[model samples]
Target chain A: MFKAIITVKLRPSILDPEGKAIEHALQSLDYTALSCVRIGKRIELQVDLDDRAAAEAAVDEACRKLLANTVMEDYTFELQKA
Target chain B: MSKVKFGVVVFPGSNCDHDAYHAVKHVLGSQAEFLWHKEGDIGGADVIILPGGFSYGDYLRCGAISRFSPIMKEVVSHAQRGGHVIGICNGFQILSESGLLPGALLRNQSLNFVCRHVHLRVENATTAFTNQYASGQVIEIPVAHGEGNFYTDLDTLAEIEDNGLVAFRYAERDGTITDEANPNGSLNNIAGIINREGNVLGMMPHPERVVEQLLGSDDGIGVFASLINAISGDVTIPGVAVLP
Candidate 1:
């Protein structure tokens, strides 16, 4: 089996409002000096396919089609044998 | 298209499809049909409406999965062919994701599901949906959503503003457009916008909810009337009085 890990994040140009609120809370607790903060999500997918190439292609298709909204976010994935 | 045929799209999780259907059928005095998302046909609908709901359980993003519904291809073509389309709340997000309309709707700034009647200023009255209201008229519409914050890049925002594509903006009851009045923190307090062709409209407000005066206000009737007017190019509603 092949396992793919995908990381999705809002584009840097876009404001992460939720992340910003967290950053402010962190500052209140004395975790300053961090100039910026962003938030994202990760998804892991396992398929029965043994070929790394095909597994990666399928994951990419998933990201482009439904896993990630390219309008305001970007996605990257890594695949490995399961 | 001699008659105004309204099509209300229904995704698996769509809860407002019936509200939209009732508003079109009874309030606007027109024939309304439900278009299933899995179906590829629009049943020759002249006006298509994407009603609001937690489609696909709001997976990945609001309206993200629903935009890929087989019905969307027909929607895009219909819009391209000068057909009128309205997306309310979740439907608004789908239109943005489908590229039928510009910009995107994000999580509400307050991180809460805002449900209330908000004053909206008609930014442009020339479109088929806003002709019933005078330019800059303030109309009360209910917005109920957790992810209604509208966002867009600066250039695209400027272009829409320059072209008067903004159909509505959050405003005060007295018609003042201010940042304080923005319920969702949408860019420029945008509540509704039309596509460049002026045929497609995507708004976060729910005009379908307040069609009757018994429900509190009859202000929303104008929106439906504007749409019926667009379809028939006349104000003669079959069984309903043409509200003045």
Candidate 2:
């Protein structure tokens, strides 16, 4: 089995209002020198496949089709034998 | 002219389907029916409405899962054929996800769910959906959503403006576009936009909720009236060459 860790994040050009709100909370709590705080989602799933190449393609397809919306978000994934 | 048929697609968790159906059938005096999401055909409807709601509980992202719904296939085909399609709020998000419209709706700048009536200036009144209203007319409509901040690349924004695809813009009562009047921080104060062909429109406001005078303001009736007029050949839409 292969395990994939996918991270989806809003693109740098897109505004992250939730992250901005959290940043304000951090600043209020005296977290000074904070440049920025952009939040994203991390999805971990296991793929039941034999070859690493096949598993890579499957995970990539999942990200492109369902896990991430390429219009406003970017996604990256790492695969490893489980 | 044959009576227009409006199809309101009811996706899982769509709360505004009834409102849309009522707006067309009772308020506008048209034939209206609900089209289940699992259905692949458009049910011979002239206008398709992707009503507002938290479809699929807005999992992953707003309108993300619903875009893959079976009915969306027909919806896309219908739009490609130059049939009229309007998506309001969550419907707008779905249209964006389905590639029927451009840009994505991000989280509101305030990080809160905004629900209230706002002024909208008719930016382009020549489209099939806005032909009843004069260009620059300000109409009052209610917007209810948490993710309505419209975002797109600078190049695409310029292209949308250059193509005159913007249908409505947030404005003041007297029709002044201002930052203070923008409810969701939509790019360029955009509240609604149409496809390049002008048959598909995705907007973040609920025009159906205000279709009757008893519902506070009847300004929204123009939206329905415009569509009925266009479909009945009472109004001519320029630049759209939909071969029947």
Candidate 3:
């Protein structure tokens, strides 16, 4: 078995309205030190693959298929034997 | 001959209804009107459009709340019957949320509100909305949104491509289609897509903004024109002649 960690984020050019709203809310609350805040999703998967290559392939396929949207986000995964 | 009546859905916060209306009316010279979000029927309109803007204040996610609105119920039914539906920006989010389209629009990776013009390639011009453009044609349109990331499963992505549902792709800085030019990081640089029936279209860019030459380039007019041609039974674009 192997474990995989997947991180997904939007591309730099696309706007993040949720983050802006949070920034405004923070300023209204007088938390001025917060310069920036970006939000993303992290997913971890455990698979029963025997080989590292197979595990990596599964992770990549997962990211490409659902975990990440190539249009607005990028995903990177790290695998470790369980 | 009866004029093709088009209706643009107006949600509470929709700021692009007028833009969409004008694009259909002034640019395509079609009869277009605005339909309130609460309206149950789309007035037998041949084409229905969901314009961009923050709906329900982006509550419960960008389009999650709007998906349940009364107008959407009708829109869903209409689209299921093979009526043409075009969702732009926030409309795209709403379509995905309503399950009329695949994938979801998540927050941008940078957590910024990106607003700019982007070049896109006409990857599949065979849909009712994209029939006026040539395959591989590059056009520029304005993009302004926070959550425009498109996501789907691997098999679904391959299936969409294999079925020729991918309508548009991002163009690189060199004006060529490539993965690197993908602005939103969408899978396969997918900028737009249509339903299996070739009637529904969802895209992030505002083609309405580019329909008039006075606004800049008129590349977007072709999208509007394509629909006009589709309903008129005069679609003649060689690239869009066959379903991919």
Candidate 4:
């Protein structure tokens, strides 16, 4: 078994409204050192496939087709043996 | 000429399907039918509308999941054949995700769900969906959405402008495009746009809700009228070579 962990976030050029709000809250809490904060989503899935090569391709396809909007967002995934 | 047929697509979570259907069947006095999202055909409809609402519960993204549904394949094929397709609000997001239109709708700049009426300028009145209004005419339309901010790359922005594909721009009552008048901070204050072929239109405003005078503003009827005119071929349509 393998566990696929994926993270999706808006591109740096695109505005991140939620991230900006978080940045403001952090600053109010006296965490002025942080800047350019970005908000993203994390998805984890456990697959029964035993082959690593086939798992990579399937994870990538899932991210591109539904998990993320490539126009303004970027995604990355990592596979770990379960 | 045979009556121009209209189809309103009904995705799983689409709540505005009836509004679009009513606009065509009642207000415009045309035949309209609901096309299920699971089906792969749009029948003989000349114009297909992807109505608003949280399709697929906005699960992955506003339109990410709905684009993969079986019906979208048919919608794409229909557009490829030069059939008219319009996406409003959530529908607009779906069109963008489905690659029927360029640009993606991002979260509102203010991080709020804005619901109100705003003035819009008919930027290009030559397409099948905007021909009823004169170019630069200011019209009132209502917008309701949290993620209506339209974003595109610099290259795509220049391409759309060069192609005259911008269909509607938020503007003042006198038809002056201004930043303050923009409802969602959409790039270039764009409220709506069309594909290069002009058969596909995606806008963040709800035109169907304003199709009747009793609904407060009838400026939206012009959009439906334009579709009817283009499909009937009673006039020389400048775009969409689907006329046979």
For candidate 3, write residues A19-75 as lDDT tens digits.
Answer: 678988999999999846666777887989899998889889867755555645777
Which residue window of length 10 is worst by lDDT in model 4 chain B? B235-244
Question: Isolated chain A: TM-score per model?
Answer: 0.90, 0.91, 0.77, 0.93
State the TM-score, rounded to 2 decimals, of chain A in model 2.
0.91
Estimate, for each residue in B1-244, the C-alpha lDDT of model 4 and write its tens digit: 2288998999999988999988778777777999999987888888899999999888878998899888889889999999999999999999999999999999899989999999999999999998888888888889999999999999999999999999999999998888889878899999999999999999999988887768876778778878988788553322321222
Candidate 3 is graded, for docking, as incorrect
Tens-digit lDDT track for model 3 on B1-244?
2277899999999999998888777766678889999998999898899999998898646876787789888999999898889999999998887778887776554556779998988888777888778887788888898777677777788889899999988786455767657666677778889888888899999998987667877778778778877888653332222322
Once model 2 is optimally superposed onto the true structure by TM-score, how far is the C-alpha of residue B196 displaced, in angstroms? 0.4
lDDT of 1 at B207: 84
DockQ of candidate model 3: 0.08
Ranking by TM-score: 4, 2, 1, 3
Over 4 Å off in model 4, which ranges? B234-244
> What's the CA error at residue A29 for candidate 4, in Å?
1.0
Candidate with top lDDT is 2
List runs of model 3 lying over 4 Å from the truth: A1-82, B173-175, B234-244
Question: What is the descending DockQ order?
Answer: 4, 2, 1, 3
Off by over 4 Å in 1: A30-35, A47-58, B237-244
Query: At residue B214, what lDDT does model 4 achieve?
Result: 80
